[model samples]
Target: MKKIFIGMAILSAGLFTSCSDFLTEEPKQEQSNELTFATFDGVNKAAAAMYGMFQSDAWYDGEFTLMSELRCGNAKNPTSVPGSGRYRSDTQWIYSDRSTSPLWSYAYYTIARANNVINNLDDKVGVDATQQQVNNVKAEALFIRALCYFDLVITYCQPYNYNATEDDKMGVPLVLVTENGKPARDSKENVYNQIVADLLQAESIMADDYVRAGVTDKAATPTKPAIQALLSRVYLYMNKWQEAADYATKVINNKKYELAPADAYAAMFSAATAPEGGEIIFEVYGSDKNEYWDNSGWAHLPYITTTDDKGSHGDVCATKDLYDLYSEGDIRKSMYKQHGNDYFPTKYSGKPKDSDPKYTNVPILRLSEMYLNRAEAIINGASIQGVTAESDLRKIATVRGASQTAAATKQGVFDERRRELAFEGHIAADYARCNKSMTRKDFDDSKNKDVAFPSYMWALPIPNRECTANPNVAQNPGY
Candidate 1:
């Protein structure tokens, strides 16, 4: 594994009084691991830091989200709008070991932090914390580690079903504990099995309504539903159709969440605080107060999707290919605003304040995805009583004011997923896992417009730094 090195600075208890403050605060200096994980407060701070680390540009705040869209057909760089020239290589499918995303290092850094908490939770549970409290902490760490591994495996390895025999295919390294020893990549199936095991363990420990204390934004933390929702996605990727459908049903049946209605759909994305109890299962909290916020600057998603006149980067725009997918009365069409000849997504249209673009929350998982996941699974031969692919798809289509035409078929479910989850970072994986080739008609580069299924380019190259540091780590094919 890549060297797991991070300063062990436990913030003062006063620093994490609430979610906003907890997410915004940065650790000052290195402390000993013994002191950092000695108390419940200390362990809580460590878990909070794990959530905060996701705001880095390499992860949710920028590249991880935008690159997925850019590489797929949903996003484009408009010639009319001025940009920072970011994501151009991704849009054109131009990648190399050096040019590949920095998500690898960032994810490992987060996993290491989570490992620190998970490894120490049991031993430290006595005076300052109860067993239940320690369990919650461990659950959070497990969820974070599983999420990071899922992202790494999907990015650095082919789809779970890429080959008939999975033993030959390698996934990213599985570093369950914080250690410095270099490790070779595990098989894709082993990596997925580990993810499922972690999530299931987390789900068992956490209460159905367990929300982390001090979190003002419930979506920032992992609740039981959130874990189940992620399991649904993971199962879908693993081609466990029945399991995927069942897990999606678990999330969908949870009355705590409901899909955002048509009128509130666009606003959900732009809310300064993540919207509570409507569609959002998990989101990356964005705030000017966040330590990484200022550094993100023009590279942020809000800036990239907004207009130049709005005092943002105004680079990424919605292609006609995606825009045309919505019917005449579909409310999702309103999420895009045209400037000259370009149509920019208003999904990240900034928050309510003057510094709007800087503090916009990014949704990571939502209830709409559960419906889509279930719908896709059912269409692909999953069984759920009283549920047809059409009915589940209509659950989303009705809210978006879209008519359900051909939602009973696999192609229709895929189209609905693209329509519902566009630019949220599902497109590339959806295409790859479903074995569908991407043909971008609206893209300018004709030579590189289409990405065929089963291509080696589906898996990104492992970082050169990782390869240099760990001779055991092998680069992905066709780097």
Candidate 2:
């Protein structure tokens, strides 16, 4: 299907929130469900509500992305002179409940909405709607649901390869319905399989034959490339290197997206509107005054609020090690501005106010990821179809100016990924998928050290609120 970008329209519909042990879907208002599935416009409005979950303080627009890098040692909090322990727990992986980490409930909250749409859409139809239209609506919900589960599993479960046979291990429960059922954790293997099933079905239903005749929003909707791109990441996590490479190759060969050139790379982030075609396959849009994290917005994150801030109140700085990864002439290197010990990247500086939303169009998938995924997969023993791992690495590195003298290697792929994806999330999961341990021993700040592989800390504890409410819900071991 030729993909069309249906820009995400914000809805006034009330969103669902979970209060039970396991996730239970409830509409934001009474009769909301009845109206939601009553007409096609209503179902789409529900879809917009799912996007609201994406705009939340805990999920993509904020902490979920922050947690990925913070716990992985890409960011830090100031050394409190005393009393004020701002980001201590986060940087130390000290999160426990939904209070500190809102991702748990919000993820399930998103999944619940998706289930509501998928299960109920059949009974409700818009005027003059075709089966294809209905199927498209359901496919979008499935994609969102699959995305939520993918995020939840990676956040709350240990690395997939933690056990040679991980089918018996626990992940967050696979809640496929909206009812208030108190379910125990499903195996990580099972959750992964479910994600695959959802993504494949989603792919099957999208209008593959629909060709884009006009412009479209890059992140507003899921596309075949987006589904394929996500499957690449999912397979990478599963250690299915061949599958990862294959899916990545599929995206790269589709000819739908061209990587933003080095000069254009920084501009892509700064576009007042979602920019014209580039490498982005999927993203979420939020502004300073609207759908932002805190009043400060997504840009308010990335750095601590500071009076002397250039673009952002620099809270989160790039680790010195991350800052040092860039070589001269690498356009990617210039993205960060080092202010003393703190470095702020201008990628999120779309609206440069002290507290305004950075106008960050949150990137969920990009062409660069596909190249990186393909390279890493090939290096890890996947068969090379059209290009070698090194060739793909050079494709990215050369464009970024990092390959002027840099040679392609397994480590080179890691370096490019870490640099290319910095602050856009994917840091910890990168380590997890590789079965590598993350440590903060190099951090200049006080306290915590290694977040070792195969540990309970790897899986965030099931929220205390849920456990307290539902006897069937089990807390993560050692939390």
lDDT of each: 0.79, 0.68
Taking the tens digit of each residue's C-alpha lDDT, what string does model 1 give over 240-342?
9999999999988888888888888888887766676689998887766666666546777788888856678777888888999988779888888888888
Candidate 2's error at 137, in angstroms? Answer: 1.4
What's the count of clashing pairs in each model shown?
2, 11
* Cα lDDT over the full model 2: 0.68
**Cα lDDT for residue 456, model 1?**
84
Model 1: lDDT to the true structure: 0.79
In angstroms, the error of model 1 at 100 is 0.5
Q: Residue by residue across 197-222, what tens digits does model 2's lDDT show?
A: 98999888778743211212335567
Q: Which stretches of candidate 1 lie over 4 Å from their true place?
A: 1-20, 23-30, 164-168
How do the predictions measure up, each by TM-score? Answer: 0.94, 0.86
**Runs off by more than 4 Å, candidate 2:** 1-12, 15-31, 78-85, 97-100, 123-127, 164-168, 209-216, 288-312, 352-357, 404-409
